[model samples]
Structure formats: structure tokens, C-alpha cells
Target: MDPNANKYLLFNKLSSQDAKKKLESETFKRTTLSFYKYVNLKDISFYRDYLYREWDKLKVLGRVYIATEGINAQISIPNYNIEKFKEQLDNDIYLKNISLKEAIEEKDFSFFKLIIKIKKRIVADGLNEIDFDSSKVGNHLSAGEWNDAIDKGAVIVDMRNHYESEIGHFKNAILPQSETFKQELPMVKELLSENKNDKILLYCTGGIRCEKASAYLKHNGFRDVNQLHGGIIDYKKQLMENPKLENKFIGKNFVFDERLSEKISEKVISFCHQCGSKCDMHINCKNMSCNLLFIQCKKCKEKFKSCCSTECKKIIDLSENEQKILRQGSINKNRFNSHRIIN
Candidate 1:
């Protein structure tokens, strides 16, 4: 057996569609969970390869980002092998006893295949790593403490994108309009410029973004910085485990998965982008050439055929060859961010 031959098997060979088919044919259930750590990794590739090999053996499938700063992962593991997977983590030097936040609304196929990639940072804030110490993050708060802080008039800031906060967030959170974490950090600072001395609470989909955000705030001289210990996912888990705690969060919690978003509360705080009807369901435009992501009600979904605009709808209606011709060297300025612009 040649070592290089086995090295070629490190990556997933199956296409996403085939991987989905294989996932559907599986008989066992899988659990979706997420975790992140800001520990230094000297050899990122070595660890990445190690994780891919080990997790592939356990039939784990999901997205994982590894950087010199840390690792951020959202993965689905086979229920039968979950214990063994946990054992594997426990044995690992870097990830031992790391906190894991299970998905609140888990689907059998949250992800189709495993994908581990190296990145510059686990959660990109665009801030120089040397400028801020990520380890000096804000004070961690539990669900009960978070509610108490809210009741006490602490400044609540949603660390996620504008689209995420549009669907659901803690009531009265200072939701920044920026679309990415890199833009949100400075926007958040400006949004709370006067509240530097005030108690500020930050949170994201998982705790990873907040970990960086809280540190950034602290570095920028914000006093009394705090964050949801495990972000919204863990907050929901805490709420489920303890009903006495008040659920300050409203509407659906937007997620980066096939399910799109999970119900955190019964309230629908957002409306469809097209008809303005009450809806929190998000979907990417069906037109591969212009995959704009936006909220669409069932009616609008059927009417538009999952396209974001009439122009996109016309393009999708064209023959395959015609569509190909249009796609050739075509520049879609509104490919992802301009759903509102095109609409």
C-alpha cells in the first residue's frame, strides 16, 4: 500500500448530490452539533487531516473551519458513533472537554458530506489578530443571567448579520445593519459609542463570533462586556432544560443549514421580501447564475419559482443552452448581497 495513494483518499470524492443520496439511504440517525475553540494550532493542516480521517471513520458530515487561531465546526455525527466521537474529542489534546452545542431543531440531513478547510481566521472580523487578544473575551453569561441583564437595561447587541437578526433575535437587541462580521464589528462600536461604560451583551449563531466581538469591544475600551455563554443555540438548549428562565428571544433563530431557521418563539417578527406577508422562511434563488438569498412566503415562492426577481425568473425559464450562454462571462453584481437591490 503506497502512502501517497491513501493520502489521495483524504478528501470526499462524491459530489454533494450523490452524498445527499447516500445520506438518504442510510438507516441510522445523526445528531447535529457545533463547537469552537480559540486555542493556537501550530500545524493546522496536520490537525485538519487528522480530523478528516477520524471523523470520516465515524461517518461525520458537516462544515469545519480551522485556522491558526482556532477551530470552528458544525457537524452531524451518527447517533451510534456519537459516544465514540465524543471520546475522540476528549482524547484530542486541543479539543479535550470543549463545550458542544447541539442543534435545537436537528434534521437527519443537516449536512450531506464532511468539508474541512483551512482559513485565515475561524470567524473573520478583519481585525489584526495582534491588535486584540481573543482570549480576553467578555464575561460569559447564562440564559438566566442574560435575561437578568436584559431586565437591568444592559445593552444587547446581536453579533450576526442583518439578515440573521431580521428573522429572530433577543428582544431589543441592537441589531447592526451590516451583512458580515467584518463590517458588523466597527458598526457595533459606532452604534454603541456612547455606551462604552455601560454593560454590553453580545451574541451570534454560535459563540464563535461573539468570542471575537466581545474581545474586540473590550480591546476598544468597552466596560462590563459580556456575551451569551454558548450563543443562541446553547441559550435555546438552556431554555429547554430549564423552563423557569424567560425566553427573551423572539421569532425563528436563523441557522446556516438546510432547515434555514429554527423556531425559538412562536412570533414571526419578519415578513416575506416580496409580498410583505408574515414569513421568516429564507431561501436562495433557484437561478444558479444569481443565487440571491432572501425570505419568501409560500405564495411568493410558488409565484417566483424560487427566483429572486422577474429578470432572474426569465433567465431560469430559458433553455439550458440559452442559460449557459447568458452565464458565460456574465457579471451578476447582485449574486448574493443584492437581493433587496434587484427586488
Candidate 2:
């Protein structure tokens, strides 16, 4: 879709100050929520257009993806439009009974503009329906049930990538070292190769990844499998409601938003990738060509000017034209360890 076609998205390269000013001017509280469903939809194009037109009127702002397999959305709807939005969703059989996860911390500016795109798959598990039996998946555990299962010594595994789990994760959970959910599945299965029959627990940022992962594990002949119903976001809400509940997860829960993460606990399980200091502050490199998402401590932020490495920091001194010229021919250096480069 042509984003520029919309008046709301006419501006570009806006400063945070400008963005905050716009957000502050808004009168209503924006509720952030996400939901997904794995159902066949042959008319995805029509469905996409229908959603865009409907949500646009409600002045929604967030990212949404729909595919033949399913729909996944994380968006901010106006407080007044909450019931209307829910009603609209309920009106559609495809979206009916979908598990919508509300954000614990409702920031009005979770998104700047709305964007709904059509994709090949909602979650991109890198596997077709033929690869696994989604019909018979793992057990869904509530926050209370999840804690109980963990206490019972079930083998807990984090389904999120290393970058996400590095900052915050359920304590004593087996964290896979892979970068994507596609890679993490096999990594996790191999990691727990010995515990096929044992009660295996899985979780992700949202519960969606676990849905696919659990199904895959079950297809591979793992008898007992379970997933946290709403993932960490729901788990945090449960802890907040009942202060007496034990929060095994620590540090910030990495989120895909302007905030980057939300503070779930006091512990910092990760460190600054540059200075090796204990920190959970995730920052993208200031260099446009090397926007590597890595953890940086306060001191390192000051030291490197929010860049991932010394080379990236130096790149900022060059003219924009020069930087672009350099970026044109080279692969993204951030994908590899920038700090480890001998140059």
C-alpha cells in the first residue's frame, strides 16, 4: 500500500519531540492489544482492504498482517472505540473468540500510523500445515497453571530468540541460541532430545510462537507439551493483579515497539554487547547501514553515542552521502559481530 496516500502518514523523518507533541494533543487513551487466529482465508486481499477501511475510520495506528493461513495484529485503538472495535471483531466469525492480549502498560503512542500488509504467513514458522498437525496441539496453561507446572519441575523452554530472552525470560528456562523461530524449533527439540515424554513447557513474547512450536513438538512424538496462555505480557498482568504471585521471569521483556522493552522485573540478565557491563538496555546502532539491535549500558551509550561498535560510531562522522555510498555495495555488517572485526 502507498502509505503516502494517507494524510496521516504524509510526514517523514519526524523527531521524537514532534511525535510526542502529536500524541499529547490526542484526547483519548489508546489501548494496545494483539490477537491472531490460524484459519484458512482465500479472500485475503478483500479481507485486507476491508480491515484498512474499517480501522482507518476508528483512527487506529499499528501493524497488522494477514495471510491465507491467519491474521496477526498489534494495534492501538481509541478507548472510546474499544467496544466498537471488539464488536467489529466479534462480528467476523474469523476473528470471533480470538485471544486478544491487552498491553499491561497502555501507552497512547504505541504506534504512529496504521499499516496492514498481506503476507505469505502470519507468524512465518517456515513450515507448511503438512509439516505438523495443528489440529492436535499442546495444552494451554493459564498464568497460575504455568507457575504450577514450572514448580512441578516441567522442562521450561523459551521460544523467543536469543536477543529477546537475553534481557528477560522465565528463570531456569532453557534458552535456545538461535536467531529465528524457524531455527529455534530444531534447536529446542535437539536441546530437549532426551525429555520427549517429560512435561515440556514452551513460551514466547506472545503465545503464538508456542502454538506452532508446541504443535511441531507434538507432531515429533512428544507426549506432554504446554504453553503459557498469553505469554509474558499476560503473565505480567497476572503478577500485577496478585502481588503475592512469584515472578520467575526477570528483566525487561523485549518488545517490537518504540519503547523496545517493558520492565517486568528488577533483575538484568543481559549485558552491554559493547562494554560487557550488566545491562538490559537494547539499542539499534545509530549508523543507518549498521542498525544492529544490541544491548548497551548507560556508560556505553555515552561512550559509543548509541552505536553498536567503534566503527559504527565513527561512521556518524562521515557525510550522509559518503555513508550511503559505502552502504550501497556492502552487506549489512551488523549481521555479524561488528566489534569482533579486526579492522
Candidate 3:
């Protein structure tokens, strides 16, 4: 797919129906929800084709992945079509009655297109079947219970990647100094090796990854292992139910979609890497050739013009033809590996 082609989707930002004539004619209101299930599928291509055709007709949008292991999805649906969407999933044996995490703030349109791709693993932990057993999953804990465990000195471990954890995490949560999800398991086991009897609580963006991860910890001799049921999304919902526990989670939850990250509280836990100022905003490199992830302060954003580095800034100024030739075959060459701002 050409990077400049209409291969991507855009959504969000809308005016009230009464405020604009263009918006007044729109009838549907969208809701963003995510769900995942780990099941052995006989034919993934068949399932993929079936879902793409069905969902595209329903005007659903978001990225979805299917593998022999299972399926992971983040999708937006029109409010009136919610029942129809649920019925569609319920009709499938593997996805029937699955718990879906609803977003706190609903956007106009969360996604502009539907993308379903086949991959080796749903969450990209890079672990083979022998490495972890998805069948013997972890103990699921609700928000109040999770808070109780934290107070009782449970070793809270953030199960997300470093960049995701940078924006928000539980207070004093032990973050593995890892850039990828694949690195979290062994590193977490090593960190909690001494406290085998201590309650080890794990959490991730959605509850998908930790479902297997917590099981992996118990397999490694961690006696008391538990996980945040439904992960941060569920926690946020529980927090809304009880205003007293508002401060439990400290920062924004980094999302993979267009919202980028969702704010849980007003507190800012991360700083702009370039200016050393308090800012948790994450942006991709403006250099189309190198879309490195970095945090740029509003001041630095204006100064650097959203480029990751001086070299990238110069590259961004190049002519379209010159940039195209330079970028040829660079997509798979790992040019942005060293430029990742997360430690």
C-alpha cells in the first residue's frame, strides 16, 4: 500500500447537529467498543471474509486481527445499530455473549474504514503455544478489589509496552523497561521472583493480553496472581460508578486508535522528551519516510514542526520525488528503531 494513498482512515471532530447545516442532516451517533476472544479457528480466511462483508455493510469501522489463536477488535457502531451488531456477534459461537468494553467519551465517528488482517498472534507477544497456556487464564478482579489488593501490598505490574505505560499507570506500578509487549512476561517474572507469595496484579490496555499473562505468572511459581478484569477500560467505568475512587488511576490510557490516548484524570504523568515540560501528548514523526513516535511539547512542536530529529526535519523539506526515491524500500529497513523516544 502506498503511504500517501487512501489506505488510512480518519474520524472524530464534529459540530453539534443544530450548530451546522451539514451536521444537522447526519442521523447516526457512533459508539466505540472493543472486544477480543481466544479460540482455535479452523479457517481464518473464511471468518475474515465473512466479517469484512458483514461489518462493511453495517458501517462499522476500526482495526481487527484474526489468527489461529483468536481475534482482537476495536470498532465503532451507530447507536441505533447496537442491537443488530450484538446479534451479529451472538450468532457466532466463538464470540457469543463476549464482554465488550465501551469507551467513556463517545466520538462522532471513531473510524472511517474497516481493516481486518491475519497475523500470527492477536496481541503480538511473540510467544508460541508452548510458551503460555491461554486455557488456564488468570483471576479477574474488579476495580474495588484491585484497589484493595494494591493497598495490601500486591506487586502491581503494568503489562503494556513502555510507551503506553509512559502516559498512565497505577501509582507505584512496576513498569518493565521494555519497548515491546513480548519483553514484558520474562522481565515481570524476574522482577517478582523474590516475592512469590505476594499478590501480583497485572493490567493492560484491554484485558486481552493479561488474560494469558497472569496465567503465565502463576505457572512460573507466583502463588498469588490476579489481573485487572477488563483492564483499564473496565476500571474507568467502575470509577465513574464510584466518584470516591477517581484518583486510583493516575494518567491517560494510550489507545491504538485515532483518539491516541484517553484521559482518565487531569494529571499529567509524562513529559515532552524534547522540552522537559509536563506533557503527555504523543505524536508521530512528520517525516513521512520516518514516522517515529515521540513526545513534543507545544513549544517544541512549533519549533521542530513535528519532525523527530534534525535529520528528519531536513528530509521533510525534500521535494516529493526526492522523498519518494529516498523512502523506497525504507519502510522495512527499520530506520526509526533508534529514534523511539521511550526508554
Candidate 4:
């Protein structure tokens, strides 16, 4: 029997700050990557715990969600242990031969700790299983094929939230204005009702949302539904590998990491929320109570002291104790629940 069988727990023990400090002090380089699959699992809890134990041994760090339907993962692993990590995945039945999408910009670490969560679904779209048959998804087009489709004037729809698209998206892509996937799914359906019969190309940060979305559209009777093979991340990878391919995406691709976005092209389509200057940087308000994620320019960041507004700046100025009291009683009416789209 292994003496340290129970040494690792199913949950992360260190605080995020502490974990980040540990990661910064690490000597070896780490690679950030993401992958997902819509495969069925008999025991999600067992698989989640098994993965946590195994990955923790390899010093892996990132967010992973496992459900009965599937598993979605975004993680960073030490360069030295990448092969070992791959071997671990290969040995596993569920994750074997899973395609990994490496981050374009790896200067900043994506995560500091490993977190395996059990959710009802891998990608939440606020729908029952009956809403859309996941098995009947759109055609997965390769990066080159996607480009060809775009050249052929196929209807392109950005299957991401407003914030995700506001930072970066393909040129002329139908950027949905919804806050969540649940809302965006129906909104997108109606937005393209007129073009239901046309060839539709859908994409997102990764291909998870589009997997569900494409099926939803097909269930609703849309014809010729197709999606970017592995979404923008994979598209960027394909473009990097092949120099001849033209990069159609503009501005930074908004990523859920310490490095907020990655450069897809040398273009800035969005502007600063405060000054209206050409900027695509997204920042959360310094005020903990009003932690609204919005775009701020370098000038406004300095002027507002990394806050969303003068009001939030004032709150941040208060003493820690005073701020606690305000948080206890005050309502965050000024905070924008959805992203602030300052176009």
C-alpha cells in the first residue's frame, strides 16, 4: 500500500495570493493550455478526485470543471513535466488523445492553483438536455476551412459574451450583446432568424459554447451550421504554424487569465470607457464592493487610481474598517452587472 495515498485532498488548500507567490518563485517554465470534450462520464466525483490527485502530483495549476456530460479544462503545467502530464492524460480513458490548445502569449502565468469543480454542465447555457441535442452539433471546420468560409461570405457570429467580443473578434462577426451564454443563445437565434437558411459560422473563446449553440440552432431548424474547429485559440495556433494564412481577427483576444487578453492582430477596435481613446484593456474596479469589470486606459487608470469611476475611487479611499461597514449596508447600484460597452 502507498503510504501517501491520502496525502492530497480533493480541494486546493492554499490561498490564491499564496499560490500566486509560490508560482512566481518557481524556477521552471510553465505552459498554459486548454481542452474540452463532450463525452459522458459515469462517476464525475470519482474522476474529479482522481484528476485532482494525479494533477496535483505533477504541479499542475488551472480551473477544471467536470460534469456527467463532459469535462472542460484550462491549465498550466511545468515544461519539464509536460510529457509526463501528457502520459497521464494518455493513460486515462476519458482524456486520452485530447487536443490541447497552447496560449499564444505565455509570459504571464494563467493560474496559480489547481481547482477541480463539479458542475451540472461543463458550459452553462441555462438549458435542459432536451433544449438541444449536443450530439447533433455543427460541422467542426479547420482554421483554413473557416478562413475559406469567411472569404465565401458565410454569416459569422461571435458565440461569446459582449465583453469577450468587445476586446477582440473576427472582422464583421455578428458580436452578440448578451451578458451570458444563456441569454446570448436565444438572442443570437433571433438575430439571425432572417439568415437561417444561409451558411452560419460560429466561434467563441474556445469551442465549448459553440458546441451547444450550434446544436441549439440546428434544433431550431437552422441549416448549414458550422464552427471553428477549436475556436479562436486553435485558430491562432493554426495561423502561427502556417505563415501563409491571413489573420482575420482584430485586436487582443480576451482570455480568462492573469494576462487579460492575447494579441491576435495589430489592431485596436475598442476604446477606453473613460476617455474614449483607442484601447482594448479590461480592468476591474479597485473598489472591492464595486468590482465592475470595464475597459480603462493607462491615463484613466492613473487618474481614477484603477477604479471604474470617481464614485468607486472615493469608496476605495475610505479606511478598511469604514469600507467593511459600507459593504455590509450599501447596495452596489452603481456597479454594472453586465459589461460596460462604451463604443
Give the whole-model CA lDDT for all candidates, comma-separated.
Answer: 0.87, 0.81, 0.80, 0.88
Query: For model 1, how does the per-residue alpha-carbon lDDT over 1-343 read when each residue is reduced to its tens digit?
Result: 7668746467898986898899889988888889999888989888899999999999999889999988999899888998999999999999999998888887436888788999998887889877768789899999999999999999999998888899899988998888789999999999999999999999988888988888899999998999999999989999999998889999888877667788899999998989889988888887777778888999988999998888889989999899988888753534335444234
Clash pairs detected, candidate 1: none
lDDT of 3 by residue, 1-343 (tens): 7886953233223433332444335686888999999888769987888888778767787789999988999998778888999999999888898899998766445555577888989887766668656678778999999999898888899998888888899999998878777877788888888989888899998899898788788777878889999899999999999988745789899887766788888899999888789999888877766777777788888888887677877887889888889888774323224335633
TM-score for each of the candidates: 0.94, 0.88, 0.87, 0.93
Model 1: CA > 4 A from native:
1-4, 329-342
1-343, model 2: which lDDT tens digit per residue?
A: 8766764432224565675677678987888887878888778888888888888788777788899888989888888998888888889878887878888775426777677889987877788777667767789987888999989999999998888888899989998877778888888889989999899999888888998999999988899999998889989988899888898888888777656678889887877776677888777778878777787889988988988778888988899888998788663643323322111
Compare the candidates by TM-score and give the number of the best one.
1
CA shift of 22, model 3, Å: 14
Pick the lDDT winner: 4
- Candidate 4: where are CA atoms >4 Å away? 1-7, 328-338
Better of 1 and 3 by lDDT: 1
- Which residue pairs clash in candidate 2? none
User: After best superposition, candidate 1 residue 238: deviation in angstroms?
Assistant: 0.9
> How good is model 1 by TM-score?
0.94
lDDT of 3 at 110: 54
Count the clashes in each prediction: 0, 0, 0, 0
